[model samples]
Target: MIHSVGNACSSGEKRVRMPAVAGAFYPADADTLRETVVSFLSEASSAEADKEVQAVIVPHAGYVYSGSTASEAIKAIPSDAVYKRIFLLGPSHRAAFDGASVNNAFDSYATPLGQVKVDREVCEALKHADPVFTYVPEAHAREHCLEVQLPFLQVHLQHVPPIVPVIIGTQDLAKLRRIAQALQPYFTSDNLFVISSDFSHYPSYEDANRVDKATGEAIESGSLRKFLDALEKNARKGVPRLATSACGQSPIAVLLLLMEGRKDLQVRHLAYCNSGDAIYGDKDRVVGYHAFSIVKKAEADAFALTGEERAQLLQIARKSIDYELARKTDLPYDSTKMSPALQQHCGVFVTLHKGGKLRGCIGNLIGFLPLYRLVANMAKLAAFEDPRFYPVKESEMKDIDIEISVLSPLRKIQSIDEFQLGRHGIYIIKGEHRGTFLPQVAEETGWTKEEFLGHCARDKAGLAWNGWKDAELYVYEAIVFGEEK
Candidate 1:
């Protein structure tokens, strides 16, 4: 039976949810809670926060057991990005009901750090959108899954974003689907989703590691079918001793359903550990914890270079090629004349063409260094180091044309439909083999989309002709500029 609490209050009065597990799950004193969270965050390696993160999966366990794993996910939020609202989803451990519970009674959620306001407008809108969403105060009253995540949020996020705290009470897949469908419209770039879960509960340490590894792989694959299949397989292997593969399975399912066809979002595994590894835990029985983040693919135009910037890169490439042909050890360059944009890190390729034919080409797929430095290095390599052709001679310098391709960050695409022959370059990876083709390859060869993907898979990636169907495919756009044009 489900009950709604705090609805009888007056209009002007705000309902506040006082912490239920303050001293038990985490520190009760504000100073201690702050210090504990700070230590966990400080110990975590700062992951590169260059992408726009959309969602994250964190473990909900006692601070002593899973706080370090949770900190990895919270710290992944880019220090610059701010969200207007945070949708907190976690399965109900203490209550059971027919549908999801939205805490309409609470205006703010309180932790030792302070209170975070509830987005009342969003909560009201969700209640109206689906009959499955109810104002069930009891479902959230004693729930620890959602409450444990707040202290970490309070410490990591720049401005503590207002939250719409939800406790998922039903394991019905259809109901979960409907809930995902109802919330689909609100899944925007400015809103963040936090799914709280702990994987593989109460198994022998060895069995827990095996089961959790399979679960993690399925989640990282970004295929809902794979995740469900893996969950079932793991559950079968973990027999009488294992209670469940994941305590928060229902919440994780809802998140997978919500992200079904989103090509822009990519899942990254952040950290993993088990209770047995903790100082307080016994090695005989353990609970597994894993952290992951969903980040948006960086757009092509977000880092576009200005016209003047493009000219400078082209000039640098041309001069470097000429210097290499002249047998000089270094290219002539003036750093004092460089623009600020030249200092930005960017992946670049330098191509040498003569009479409209490809002579030599070389590049760096990942931009680890400054843009200007990459251009200078790749320019010499394209002219002198490309294995397909001999080094360009001084006599041929007058006939050569220099072209530059500046790439946007690569994004993993969900389906072949996401790729356009003339607009997007393709990158394919299967096992240890990898391959790439520029956007211009299609235009120059006049190949259809399928042909372009097939050649890249078979010839370039050394996989079967249809290997892309099962392989990981990434797409990016390039700003192609040449001296002739």
Candidate 2:
């Protein structure tokens, strides 16, 4: 759920960041600004895509020069779509720093369009997470890059969600990656990322086109090395009248870093032009503008079970554990009464926690038996056979909470980067040894992705902390549920 910034600053002094370039960059009047943005969007030739557009890289020059191109890119974010919040990532044109800055003081930012609320909660979260994120008031005070995009969003979107305005101030690549890591959680479909940048600044019209094309293609490649090399390669050519390839390169790098190794996204070049293309502008010196959309592929649930099915499985697990406690040799089940879903084969893990401490947990990586049978067997094994703890006592069952993890098939991961923390469980296996931690382990431990793998490799797999680098790594997701009480 989203909390409005108004409520956050209601008791405190209300602070609004008034637009710094409303009249100079875009229309000063709200109606004129609305008309200009709407016209540009309507004139965009880029067809609305079928896939979900998660992010956009657009130019942030004055409306007369880059407005059309920016509109072309913003169009990719469907007008009817709603987001939890929009993160406006732009370069710090006025101030420089080591990392990005989040708005800590502002309640909202005002444009000719209206006041766009700032997400205070998100800002606080980032600030507390790491030193890389902090309040640099000077960085945001008069920044025009993010300011210019507010109107386009207000006009095109049906409802403008609260924004988390971030100014990327670092030129250091490693710091950019750290900034990306901090922002990764919000880089999902529920949120939108607007990367404000202008390409090929102060170059001749012809040279701007040539340079911008290479740079845009590099961004489209979604390879960090290629993107950075393209910039370096462009500089090597010593194109006359060139100042910088992309003024917003820092923020763009942050976006590229966040997008690293993501295979499900398709980047499309929406529109391209330059200030030279503008009637009021000249060809001698031009700033190129390009709009690109990062679209996410459709996703389907890997596995799903009905509410009744989940209840039945839990009952089967509890009964199986009870039978084991009573020293029963066999578990009796009526196969004819079982649903088809229960008959499907899948790996399972059953965990027992007594008074919030792990008592016993055991699971199988491969399922040769039906799901119902697997759950029963795993439940019995977890309660009585886990090596880390003694068998669960029958009297303790009343206070023990049982959790079941039903897993999808294990997939051999090409890179450890593919193993998302808090989402996928990783299994590291060397020739004679192997170990795995469930997906929830990351949530429970609050470990970074690297730390998660290191622990699994060292402690769980009986290998070195960096042993996963050489060992074969596989990842899997689970539909985890626990007992109601």
Candidate 3:
């Protein structure tokens, strides 16, 4: 029969009985750890509520080494959740194990914050598979890989859920896959999957950034084979110094497999840095840490753009030239520059082209500026002030292809559920002012709608997203066109 492994806590006991890293790593005193954890959580950037997170990869080192990166991912987790369990998978740094070691102890793991019950049923299911798995307490004793994540979860989740912690110590890809496949039933929307890993080791800060970026690119591109190749190539560097990343390579493979069915599994890089960037720099030897999230897909037909609309935008660009030449004086391009009749109903597009290449493009989603006034104002700014591209030159004007996007009115939606990338341009309206643009805004640059919205939110709207909830939304059609100078 299954049973408790550690000493049971008495009614008079103030805390659960579990090992603490104490003075060796973070502050040993409970109050000190609490203050540090609370401070870190407070500094975290807020995440959007509409953004559904399915999986994440975080780093595991002392707070001084990788806490910031790990904290970013933890903060991004959906703040409101009631998942049945959390499956934390990490690589072993201390003892050796053949495949997976399920922590079968009955005692709850105590963190500086509180206790997380070990999910006995899930642990037993993974262990019952036979010779490939075992229940080992020794393997986890000195391992900080999984232990480091516990505090973050405690702080964010608030309500403690059962945990299935596995320390992977082998390079058996096949075994890892089989276990992952076997656990498929457990990875549902109601369950959260966490994979802990750190990037580059020993490479200079510059070299580490380059190396880690390659892995990040592969992860973002959703290429499992490429990720594996990166690891293998790093391993072949030499016998003494293997290029190991996210040490739990096998676990990552399984996560990728489970995430395959999802098309919108976006990889968000929350934070990245090598030991070199830390306050106390370590140029000679250092490990890299990164935090990332994967999101699920909610709709189909998300990224297609039509051609006729493309032509309409360019037409608007040409018209902008006249507006700019008319108002090139000291006055800024605000509402007062236009005639009374033209002030209230113009659709504007600020488009830029540099050295014959399309550059920065920004616009309104509705007819706030008159068609002519909007086109003219945006064209001038597009050419002269676009931050993405060098300013348009008098010499390059002949080669520049100016485009304008006159937008349709926005339709307020109840939720993100109504979003259509190629069809609906979204306007997120709140308070006195608002920001808007057509979905084609992203298509013009060939960026995915998700990528487009992220830039627009940060660059256009300047909204610090708490998550897409009941915010007012408007969708509009765009007539885009361009012409030769």
**Can you write out model 3's per-residue Cα lDDT over 106-225, one digit (the tens) per residue?**
446766566787877667767764446677767666666776788778777756578888877667666765666545545555667889888887776766776777777777766667
Candidate 1's TM-score reads 0.60
Candidate 3 runs further than 4 Å off? 1-17, 49-51, 129-131, 235-243, 300-485
Stretches > 4 Å off in candidate 1: 1-12, 238-240, 299-485
The lDDT leader among the candidates is 2
Ranking by TM-score: 2, 1, 3
Pairs in steric clash, model 1: none
Q: Give residue 383's error in model 3 in angstroms.
A: 69
Please provide, for model 2 over 1-485, each residue's C-alpha lDDT reduced to its tens digit, 9 standing for 90 to 100.
11121222232577878777777888888888888988999988767644577899989999999988998888888898878799999988888788889986888988767788888978887776568898887888777898888899998899899999999888898788678766765677768999999999898999999999999999989877788999999999999979999988988888876665355677888899999999898999999999999887575324578888898888889989888788787664667779977876566898888888898898876554678998998888898888888878889889988899998766566697788889898877665457899999999999999899999999998999999998878888899998998
| Comparing 1 and 3 on lDDT, the stronger one | 1
- Least accurate stretch of 10 residues (summed lDDT) in model 1? 1-10
1-485 per-residue lDDT for model 1 (tens digits)? 11222122333687778778888888888989999999999988765764578889999999999999999998888766778789999988877798899887778887778889998877877787789999776788778898899999898777888999888988888898778866654565677899999998888888888889999999998877788898899877645478888888888888877665455567899999999989999878899999999887663225567888888888898888777766687655777777766765556789899888999998865554567888999998999999999988888888999989987656667798999888998888664567889888899999999999999999889999998888878887888988855
